[model samples]
Target: MKTIEIQIEDYITNDKDLISVIKRVIKDKKKILLQAPMGTGKSSLILDYLSKEFNILMAIPNTAQIETIEKRNGIFCLYGDKQQKGYRSETTVVSTPDRLLQATECFKTKNIDCLIVDESHELYTTANYRPKFKNIMTLQSTLKNTSILHMSATPQANLTCLKGFYDIFIKIDSKKKLKTSIDIYDMELNPSNIKNIINKYKTNNNNTFIYFDDKSMNEELAEELNLINVNADNKKNNEILSEIKAKNKINENIIFTSVIRAGIDILNEKNAVLIICAKSNLTTDDTIQLIGRFRNNLSKTVIIKNFKNEDTEKNNQSYEQILNQKKKYLKSINDDIKRWEENKIKYTKEDCTEIKKKLTELIEIFIELNEKGEKIEENHRYKINTHRVEISAYSQLQKNKTKNIDNMIKLLEKTEAIKIENIEKKDLNKKANKSFNKKIQEKSTEKRELKNKELKQRIEYLSNNLSTLQLELFMEGSTLKTLEMTLEKGQREDRELRDALRKTLSVVEPKSKYYKTIQQIKKYITNDIRDAFKYITQRELSTCKKDIIQEQIIRNNISWIKDKNVEIATDIIKNKIIFIRHFKILQILDNYGLIKNSSRISKKILKKIEDILIKEKYFDGIKKKNYQKIIMQDLELIFNLSRNNKEIRISSIKTKNMNIENKKQTA
Candidate 1:
């Protein structure tokens, strides 16, 4: 195997930890895990190591971002009928597992090398990751021979899921930065005040994103912002990057979104503020991911949190346990930072600032502990998460009442069974009456009438389309006339042959060869529809030898003057009728701008009609009917004046009856 070593410094600023892992993984030809918060230069770091011959598979959650990665790597994605052929030594970044699998197959067939999984955290989960791993295993020998790297900010709870391939792990600690300034603020304000702060910051900087927890809240906030003449759009993973680009081009300041957890890269912003709702419990993972959005940007981050204290009375023990775990976790993290600093490790100014912020947060937790009437141990590391403090405090206050409630329940249970039964009987009678009225109130004639009216409207729509088709057929002067003439002559020629088919069908002796031939022809026609539209000219009939043979067999099998003769004539006429039906449908589709490539408009029309016959049961049955019967039905139900009169009169009578009933009800 050939290799080219590259310096990671050019791609990342102070990414020493990441560099060490990559070098180790590549040297051992093993998979590596690179974890960092959002906005970190993860993509660029791996791209730097990639060469012209590198066979990479970079997966991201967003299609637009993946497209950008594809463009940057000079990769061409196949669309529609295009063949998958690599133009040169370019990398591929696909958004879906299936596409990635297909592309991996292409790489293996072409002897392409190297594999990289971006946002590898998503792959650790069973849903997508397991299938993706299975797909790559097909190319296991080749992939195992080449270098593979997985980069993500979050590792799945069980590392063994990825440990099969990734033996080395590297973590980029954003908290280690000294200049990564973080300021936490508790702001209690109404919607108007929140709007004021947003306007102030956006007026100062154009690149800003406001993330909400969900779509409903995002929509409410967006409507409020729009009223103030602020431009805002809801963020979809597919459109966020492009929307942001367009906003940047026009210098639009604000992006409102509910994508608080997804990794998004926003460049060139000086400052950002996050407004958190107080009455919600967002997880630690969620909070860290949201904060990570501001990490890589050289901007000071301010978190405008609305922290509502919780009532811990009911869940005090559980809350205390969780609080203790958080303290231990934070203490360990702080101690690690302290060790790095004392050893004069290669620390940036951002690293020192993050340590100070952690210290201040830890101090605030200790202050809360004292206020909660809990004793603090001297020199013991005091630490806690916000949720835990709220729970424990509530528990202490509710202890006395909980005991009293238990005593009350015990006394209630000792009451006489007969006396309690009488009270329950009266309650049940009252509840039954309430339930009966609720059921009766819901069964309204008006609601039933409305539903029936909608169904009738749909039936009328189908009937109208059927009628219009008959009218068009009758009024035809050019195309329909030509079709009718050819069809009539064909039916005359097939008259005798069709008669023989019925005679044979009726006489149906158990071992008759004629019956077998007819069955075979029917089966052949069923399969021949797929290739029937490919016939362009009489010269191409030889190419459609199977359909031609089946057509001939059906024509020659008729042995009677009436029954079998009529069957053959009908089959021939039906074929021509289908062609006419297809031509009419194509014209409609063409007129509506549904058909492109009008040069091959005739072929496309035929194919679409064949497709409809195959897919729709009703149309298939209609097409298989005797042509004369089809024409008779078309005339009676559609073109005949008496049929139209009867339909109109029935509708009018029903409408008049409905009006009479409405008047009577109102009276």
Candidate 2:
């Protein structure tokens, strides 16, 4: 293979020479390997210029990049599960490698003139360690007929594999240097350390991006610092990037993982990068790619931990040694499979089943090892004596010392590539402790105030509603009592009047005019007395029904009040209150007139209540089993219920009715 170096400035000013070289390589039907620093217009050269000349199929690293490239260049892009139809008909199409692998049949039907693998280093660095490496190898085999162009800022691949097809290797060295100074803090990254760094940066009013590999930790830190976190799962990444690029004054800092490391550009001059490197899996190349995301050539600050992983450095093995082990493992598995095949006839059914399970496990391991070995041979054949293709930043930095970083960081003191400082542990502790204590106090005060406010509001709501319900119940009780007393008094008077009339009729009905007049008066008095008794009896019955309905309303209101209080209760007391309130409510409802006569509350009723509570935004995060248990236990206590297996025996309690007619007749 021939190697050529071109100045990026010269190519940008007059790219006829580089274009001529690409043309010559194309004429010779040789694949091209283009290496250039990030933010030097690699994607632009392909999509804007190269596509106009030749039919190109650019394979991006991710869907976000695919969308970004499509939107910026107005090209046909395909990715994800749903791909655009007839993408092969377009002269220039962009897609992810996985999407390309999935659409192998479509590509085989049409000709892809030249395949550009953007960020192609991922083939060895990322996919080599995963199951998808096999798919990538298959993709390489499937597209072997097409001319390939591999491009990246930090390129690492199997030179032996490419030597057969890729004859020309071009490296673009940029004349312009980044105006970013890196500060290497020799400390571990914890919540406290991170907060101190963020607070320091925040004091300067500079926007910051903190990079951490753990998504959960990133989110926790983001929440603690009140910053937006962007990751692979965050759907608003594009919007966040757009806001940052547009210089919108939003959050002073943002937290991110590896999702935005490459293929995305943030052209903000005032932005600073803070990378937490303790116990991380990021390579030096990845770190550079992350720093390169800020495209502007203005002076900026970059902070990273000077973390060194001694174990990774000490345990490093040569690629050849690892490859030999994998090959040996594969050979052993193959031998085992051969032996199993030969002796299978002698094995019983049970033995065969066990053997089949073992064989299946071994086969999966064999496939993984075989694919890994192929990838190693293709990507790391030339680097047999070196460590694995992707070296951790800690190992890489330790190996290279502080003088040079593969010509990437350069480690020049004048350029401030690596700034090492002796940060005092006591000072950091003091500052972190002070900040932490202050935060704790602030949060405590805030929480206390919030709790009080919430408690006050809940009390106000429940008290006001409860008071109204209690007053209604009181009024109904008082009215019912008054009606009963008045009915009794009227009945007594009616009885007295009827008795006197009867006596008068008995004594004077047989006589002349005087006796007849007494009889007439007696009859009138008896009829009047009867009418009054009937009216009082009817009124008493109506009052009794109203009182029953009113009592039910009061019970519902009380239950509702308890439910509302559950929200304001402390965590330590929440479940206890829930159990007590839920139990009481269920007991009342089981025997209440709303449900038909049943000793035990049915699951249908429980579920209905649950649905109502859920709709009302109650019982959040409570387990369904716990809720059911509470209700069931209460029902058992109320109805003297017993359970035998799944069957429940609940003692029936007969409902009572008011015998108002009997009382009236007696009176």
Candidate 3:
């Protein structure tokens, strides 16, 4: 919980032995595996060296390890935080696989001095969904300067047999096999035996920690304990932990549970109990880790409730076989050691430590069997409480049968094994004939030389044709690529030019305004131009137009100039036309008088305008019946703007100019 400011250099003097070993292996670039118990300070020792000795990139399973480095101010390291804890200055906790992969990508761009993997056993069992270990391996391959320091309490025994790691340093403590004193209590009182044992402990009214083999069993026992009361006191949170600790310390009454396994520590407990049923078969790894909780190194009681009716023969046989296999491995090594001088082979202290650890496990198994008074046999029966149960050692041995033997049993069960009871003379004759033919039928195979010759000929022919096609395809592709590039370039240039012209036109005033201004000057209008000025405006033309004037109005227009008597403003705009016609429209406007002075709208004119609009095929091929309403509207605007009335003529305005001819005339 406290902040720790740790420097990489600080580890140079700390845990010197572990640091020395790590340094030596890394210097020589050797693959090393450190085998230590859970509470022997394995993670701390290696982590300390890695933190101080190098720029560490540590990958741990959970948050606890990451928190340690974060509190210490470890420099430029990667860790994981499951509790949403934020990263420190030099520490980044990659809590998820996606984040871890991102960190790996960053690592590729730079150098990481070392990759320290905690709980390294997770590497072997990693599935497709869990790609953290796989990604770490990938990063490892990319980092040439980086060294890997993998730490685990349980490592795969077969890893050393793999290539590229032949010369591996295995440091394990053989003599330090975890030892704890386990006891069995016979609660002989009453019909419900275990209940009596609980009652005896409840009388004392202290904390009781009980362990069960399975989750369901633990729940069942907890429910039963909940029902019991002692002096009106209820077991609550504070009382539960305290009772567990006391029971562990005193090695007395406690509820049994599976939580005693793994990295949990119970050093402060006065006593503890471990109840092993006939169904329990704890492996060495699990047993060692569970026993590690008894940290006091003081005498502890492990109450194993051996039920009277349980059958433990099968488990006992399995335990013995594992013990025998280990013994065989050690005996072979010992025999080699006796003849080592003749063989000219030598081993160092480290090698001895490795060998001893392996052998000691075998020795410990034998010791457990002796202590538990377990008898090994081909078949055995035992009494648990009141019932007799049989345990056959043959059940364990049956697993070793071959696939053929398994098939034979299934064949017999299916009546396909030629049962004597179902066999007839014809059946016997048929089977005998099949067997005779199979033995002497002379099974022939293809000739080696003929097959090889045919295969080689086909291969050569295909190879020649493939090469020819490849060359032709390559030449064709190159030519095609060049043509494509040329075509694309021309198309791109055309688009660019059109885009530029469109942009220019967007900002320019409409050409209709030029004609409208002149018309306004001649109209004798006194008031400021109203919104209707917009109606007379024409849409601007695109850059590709052939005729500027026609495009100005007709290209995208709703009306056009009409009255032939209206004079053209020629001297100022000779090419411009001025007319007072019922300006026909192809598209209708909502309100013609409301149109702005500088805008373009398309609309069919009124009835009179429609008459003129039809002159240019305004509604060409359009059924009069289908769009009769819009057609009527087209005609209405034309009638309103006809020669008789509300006509508004537009004109273009200009600037004055002086000529040289005036001066000549004056002279």
Highest lDDT: which candidate?
Answer: 2
Pick by lDDT: 1 or 2, better one: 2
lDDT of 3 by residue, 345-374 (tens): 443343333333222322222221222334
Quote the RMSD, in angstroms, for model 3: 40.7
Best candidate (score: TM-score): 2
Instruction: List ranges where model 1 is wrong by over 4 Å.
Output: 1-24, 36-40, 76-95, 110-113, 124-143, 156-165, 172-208, 226-243, 246-255, 259-264, 276-282, 291-667
**Over 4 Å off in model 3, which ranges?**
1-18, 62-110, 122-143, 156-166, 172-179, 183-209, 226-262, 274-281, 301-667
| Position 73, candidate 2: lDDT | 74
Candidate 1 structure quality by residue, lDDT tens digits, 377-451 = 334334343333333333232232222323222322332100111111001111123443343334444454554
Q: Candidate 2, which segments miss by more than 4 Å at Cα?
A: 10-14, 83-88, 101-111, 127-136, 142-145, 158-165, 236-251, 297-316, 333-667
Per-model tally of clashing residue pairs: 30, 1, 60
Q: Please provide TM-scores, in order, for all candidate models, with all chains considered together.
A: 0.38, 0.52, 0.35
For candidate 2, give the lDDT of residue 133. 38
> What ordering of candidates by lDDT runs from best to worst?
2, 1, 3
